[model samples]
Target: MIPLTLGEVARVTGGQVHPGSPGTEDLRVTGPVVTDSREAGPGALYVARRGEVADGHDFVDAAARRGALAALTNRVVEGLPCVVVPEDPDRLSARPDRPPYDAVTRAFAALGREVVDRCAAAGGLRVVGITGSSGKTSTKDLLAQVLPALGPTLAPEASYNSEVGVPLTVCRLTEDTAYLVAEMGASGAGHIAHLTAIAPPQVAVVLNVGSAHLGEFGSRAAIMEAKSELVQGLVPDGLAVLNGDDEALVETMGGRARDVGARVVLVGLGERADLRATEVVTDERGRATFTLTAPGLGAPEPGLRVALQLVGVHHVGNALAVAAVAHEWGMPWEQIAASLAAATPRSRWRMEVTEREDGVTVVNDAYNANPESMRAALQSLAAMRRAEGRTLAVVGGMLELGADSDAEHAGVGALAARLGVDHLLTVGEVARPAATAYQQGGGARVSSVADRHEARALLEEELRAGDVVLLKSSRDSGLRVLGDELAGVTD
Candidate 1:
């Protein structure tokens, strides 16, 4: 973070500095801003937030013990220097379903906005905001890897796309930082808009809109409206990169960009795209190799060929988005291609592949799942099946699907059967619909397990040397942790 004195932080956040010692208001914060006490270090300002389970105020002493300079809290801490931001009066009556955006969180968000404004005014900082139903993290990871070749780039640590997460990411900016990749996520209207206000992007990339959060937004059209907020937040000279293959997005987002007077670039595998991919092919390992063409952007030669190290053909769209951003920034096509080709999966549990000593391959894509990504992972799993090996898919229930939950799960099972998967193991009562569908579809051995324990036991008994297995589900289903255990990953 750009160094800020306690007094400066208090003024920016509309708080008052309560000194633990004399002259504390003049002390400078030069380290990372964190919410978790364990991550606190010298010069760190720990944000004391009230969560559903615990209050961050209780951890002020823990943070101070770990070298934190002060705390940003709703109330004063006895021993720790604090920037006291008052709690919102309406917080006590907030709806049970809404996200908790209390006073301290809002104040922390203000501090993040202040830091970003200061950094941009100092020059050379270009903020890029990315939003979509799926692929946000994958694309953010890819851009974080590729953009640094141009200059210093800072992206969120993991899937930090929420209100607090966006601020946490923005506050990390230093004076020399050249790029900020803000991955924006939304469960309802105005979530993206609020995040965009914190770090307004010069470039906004809206990936495809799907059924990832259909329950929350009620419909795909509503989801599109929420995702379009990023483009709507752009300034007149800003750019909007959209997925051309998704006609719905192209129509809606293109209009939004025009309304905001921002320039637009469409990226996809289709011919209508300004930046499109050709000669796309995936190797036996399910990695994609494609030729990227952007005739509209003034290419030097025939076009660049990009080979991705990340698994799955779905990543081809993500790669094109990255290439478009780099090209807009005037990065050499050769450098962009090389950087993309050299990049690997930095984030965990999304199409993360592991090979056992006995030749069995495990595809751990259980980070989070919706119908779109679940289908994509299954397709890659089928593609990566060894010539003589059986393909196995251990799937858990996809949560937050609302009324369509059963049908969605059934569709996944039917897809597995049609893809010629040799075995289907569905875990939990919520996933029983999938097992029923898979059995009815035939041509495969299907089993239903009550939990991950039974599923693991079944796999341990049935998995063979040449078999390839895939684990997929939403984050709350616990399938990601089970995948880690199955793959012998210890942390």
Candidate 2:
């Protein structure tokens, strides 16, 4: 992070330098700011948050022993140098259930905003905010690979797209960092807006509005409103890159960009898009190859061909969004295409294809799942099926679908059967509906297991050397652990 003295940090966060740390106000924090004491190092400032499992205040001494410069806390630490943000009595009375450490969280957010503002003023750092129901992480990974060719780029390590995650990501920036890719996710209406306040983007990309959080947002229309907050937060001279094929995004977010005085560039496979894919085709391995055309966005008349190493045909839209952002930054088409083609998946457990010594192929996409992503993964697995081998799917429950959970799960099962999956194994009681639907949909071989162990045992008994298997479910379903074991991935 950009170095800041304790005095400056205290001022920025609306905290007071405790008397125990008197005369230490000039001490500068030069290391990373971390919430976990285990991650604290020399010059690091440890943020003492109160979590449900354990209180961060309990780790103040541990952080001090690990070379931490100071602790940002709600209560003053007796011996440790500290910046204390006291809880407001008014808020406490207004909300009796509010945690006392909420003050510290608010201070931490303020500190993150200050750091980002300082970095942008110092080196002209460009922030790119990406949000979608499903594709945020994948697109962020693609941009992380492509943006570095132009300048020093820092993106969140994985799916760090929450209120705390966004601020933590911003606090990692340095004076020399040129681009920041902030992946924003939302479970409710105001979630994305809260993240955007911390690191407002010069370029915002909205991939799609889908049913990933249908239960929390209540409806697709509400999800669209939440996703549009990123566009609404764009700077006056900012650019909004949206998926034109998603009619809701084009109709709503396009107007939002205009309202904010930001230019909009639509990307997709449709002819209405300003930057679109043409002649798209996916190989047997499900990797896509497409010609990129963007006459509306000022590309050369000759279309650029892009070949992606990613393992899903749906990624053509992701690649197009990356191409749009890179093109807007004046990156040549050849460089962008080469970077995308050479880029491999950086994050784990999403369309991760692994082959065993016995030649069985496992597509481990069990990181998380919703109806849209589940259908996409199943289709990608079907595309990889060999004539000699059977296509099998081991799936678990998709959580947070509200009243539509059963029907959505049934739709996924029906799609898997229609896609010619030879064997279907549905794990957990929540997923039994899918098993029932698959059987009723004329799937010849189907099984319902109580847990991952039963599913694994069934696979071991029935899986053949040439058979291809897909592991897919929500993160909480524990299917990723089974996928890791099957693919021989450790830790």
lDDT, candidate 2, 1-491, per-residue tens = 88988889899888888763457888899999999999999999999988879989999999999999998999988657888988876643433223232787778888999999999999998999999888889999999999999899999988999777888899999888899999999887667777788899999999988898899779998889888999999999899999999887789999999899999998998888998899988887889899888887667677888889999988999998999889888899778888989999889999999989987999999999999899999999889988788899999999988888999999988988899899999999877888888988999799999999988998988888888899999999999999998989997
**Cα-based lDDT for every prediction:** 0.90, 0.88
Off by over 4 Å in 1: 20-22, 91-100
**Model 2 lowest lDDT segment of ten:** 92-101
Clashing pairs in 1: none
The total number of steric clashes, by the backbone 3 Å criterion, in model 1 comes to 0
lDDT of 1 by residue, 300-330 (tens): 5588898999999999999999998998898
Candidate 1, which ten residues in sequence have the lowest lDDT sum? Answer: 91-100
Best by lDDT: 1
User: Model 2: residues >4 Å from true position, as ranges?
Assistant: 89-101
